[model samples]
Target: MSTTHEVTNQVPPLVGHDVAEDPALLEALRREGAGWAEPELHEVGRLAGSEQAQEWGRVVNENEPVLRTHDRYGNRIDEVEFHPYWHSLMDVAVEHGLHGAPWADSTPGAHVARAAKLFVWGQVEAGHTCPISMTYAVIPTLRANPELAAQYEPLLTAKTYDFGLRVPTSKQGLIAGMSMTEKQGGSDVRANTTRATPAGDGTYRLVGHKWFTSAPMSDIFATLAQAPGGLTCFLLPRVLPDGTRNRMHIQRLKDKLGNRSNASAELEYDEAVGWRLGEEGEGVKVILRMVNNTRLDCLLGSAAGMRFGAVQAIRHARHRSAFGSVLVEKPLMRNVLADLVVESEAATVVAMRLAGATDRGEEILRRIGLAVSKYWVCKRAPVHAAEALECFGGNGYIEDSGMPRLYREAPLQSIWEGSGNVAALDALRAMARQPETVEAFFTEVERASGADARLDDAIEGLRKELSNLEDMEFRARRVVESMAMVLQGSLLVQHGAPSVADAFCASRFAGDWGVALGTLPSGVDTKAIIERALV
Candidate 1:
């Protein structure tokens, strides 16, 4: 006997929908004063949600980059060959100004607008954003050396993206990468043994091995090597001014668990030519600018992951039915979906708020705020992905469901730029070194203090925690988490719906929830929150 299976209750393809059209994101953008960029964001959202974009994401991952160490003639030419889809994605991102739009256009709310575009584009493919982010971040570091900035800034900030290895002068545009980590020093750049010997004309010959050099095919890179003065930042170009390739050799490509579409290489600089970016012994200070910008991107990327997962899960629940009722109508399922919705919105608000601070030049608030948001938002992503996946039952576990990709991508943001411990410690350091930062952070959070009693109480507790300095390092994570919760609650109270803010405060601040999801108290409007999250 032969049996035939019929497809009945499966959800249809979620295509032709604009991710930028998400109500929570639009609301946040408006709150941040970036609503002027809405039409462009809507276009990006349409592309991100299109069927072609989805296929490109899948195909790029399926066809991982190929490392070509040399040609058949045996010349030393190190290159990475990517699938055409990867270049297509890069083209779209560059054309849309995802690489350096904010830096190029210094209009009001430029950073916030760029953040929104990145949040939308990241939902389609994340790997290609690595080079784009590095290119965007290198601007501030490059500005430290005006000569280098004059030489490279135009190329980096150009609207076009010229792919493949080529001379910077010959291309219409350029991208950049970074080589920071060594085999011995993972996050400690001071421990690096790369030696830089002075060459003529303020240049140096750097001989070192970098363990992780992402987007190795880029036209230029910002790296560090020890000089006579101390550890210093250097700008290394792939092609020399004489129209020859530099001595940078690709040893091998890393086999990462995710982000397979982008190539990360272990490289050796055999006396590679490098130009000093800042005064000697100031590499840490100079690189910190780039690191902080990348850290913000990490926060945005994680929030985008949460939005993607929630949308997918909610779409499935709304369509799938069991026990004679649609899954979304089920009481327990509504609670779970609402929990996911609240988390996503909290992340969105905090990320946008940080971007707004950047635009307003609130340096003190940005310092501590970045660390807090980076720690909490990235830490929450893995759990968010897991819960969203569970909402799809067996189908989510399958590769075709797209949930596994999101789950694999969730933990990366926490590990990248800086891990949770690193961010938490940075927060503590900010408080110790610049006590004014704490006051600034509180001032920002206090904007919504009177709106909710529970949030006010949480803010008071956080203040008390800040007063005690003993054992501060050990309790750093807890304190940061509290700061994050209070800040998120404050934003929701100020900009979000009354029901959303009430739900967040009751569960996150007032302790009306449980460890597991689907435990919001009975009177909360779970249905409304879930409906808003459904894209």
Candidate 2:
């Protein structure tokens, strides 16, 4: 394999190197890593057997004849006109849309949906990084400047292709919304000082700089600016209303850690024509809703990348023996690999459930679920990938080994699309508002599991513990823990693909406990206790 990808100038995004070697620290890491355990292959077999899934798989595989030739980045040779793999994803996306892609497939929770989302992300990871998915952002941004909407109306239909006008809304085009992360501001759209002024009849002049614009060439952008009421979303077309120059300038492409295939750039929008997305102050709200897809996308993409890294590590460890034995045969390595596989599955479950809920139009549930899943899995990804990389010994440290790309990319998952801290805060706030929403959320979770009696006992016990706590910090922590439990248990029950009886049982179990738990105090500890009981 080629080692052409550079690593310098790009600091590894993880904090504290070699922390895994510390005995006390390693134990905690080990414990956290074990949360995602290897389940029976049967859990995944349903997806493998799903006719829709199999068909999508065939789409990817059929294109493999072409895909194999390119690097993970979609950099093709001079002779190659177009990578057929692009369309492979479109088929799956349309299929997913038709079959309720991520949510309604009955393949067990959200893993399949996450798998689909990640599949799209991998293409972006391979080389399609543009934050153009901000199509939702345009609605609010254009609300204030609807006059220019006609110019970019074609871009809204997802038919964008080739980075210019008459763009086909190909699978690759969905990446357009990634442009928000310029040097100016990403999640903190309020911080962006990028200015836009009216240039007479409905045309506005734009002036500012941004860093980390994922796809500079995407057809549309869900970018931000300081409008009269507050920060807002804007719809900027790559071309003018008359198909002339739009005046949005690209400064330079950024050199990134991973996801190199999608280039990041410093951008300068100079006297660029502009259209707004929603009402003035509504820009922030609209952008958040629009880019929520990217947040979920980030969560699943990073998780899938972690999964790919683990499989590679396992394959390498199995083939490359040390101490005169295959790595799998060693007790220590076996333990490591076992934990890695299961946790990856667990992460998939968390990510997919959120995707399914969102796909099903369960807005509030989707918001909380996606936020929680993104926070947990994005943070968890590197820990597993790093361990899997360690199994490669010295090979893991080298770019040729492929572990480093994942390691580098892992940190970005948490940082992008609102940091983990932001997501956690948002989640707690949401729970506080609809205290019952959390209960309803968990009820759905419990119903999926058919009443794990121990879980009920554990939650009841935790309720007592939480009821004793008057401290706000402790209460806050408990809320997170409770949410985590519902998320995990709900996903396992709903999507676990157990026998019909088992599914029925899990549902009943979850449904009863969910209602019971909701009736109790907010400071519940059932999930933590249940987790402890399992240990």
Q: Which consecutive 10 residues in model 2 have the weakest lDDT in total?
A: 17-26
Angstrom error of the Cα, residue 293, model 1: value is 0.4
lDDT of 1 by residue, 342-370 (tens): 99989998899999988888899999999
**Model 1 residue-pair collision total:** 0
How does residue 110 of candidate 1 score in lDDT? 86
Supply every candidate's count of residue pairs whose N, Cα or C atoms clash at under 3 angstroms: 0, 59
- Judged by TM-score, which candidate is best? 1
As a whole number from 0 to 100, the lDDT of residue 79 in candidate 2 is 17
Cα lDDT listed for each candidate: 0.90, 0.50
Off by over 4 Å in 2: 1-117, 120-160, 164-175, 181-186, 433-436, 448-454, 457-482, 497-535
Model 2, CA-based lDDT: 0.50
lDDT of 2 by residue, 1-535 (tens): 4568754322222211221121211122222232121132222323323444324433432232111223457642111122344344333333233111222234433333333433333422333322333343333333445554444443343333333343333323332343465454555667788776766675456678877665565565667776666666677766554656566666555666655544456667777777766666676677666557767666666656655555555566556667887665665555455445444545555665565565456777776777667777776676777877787788789865556666776777777777866767767667667676566565655564435554455455545644554664435545554555556544544443232123223333244323211122222332321121110
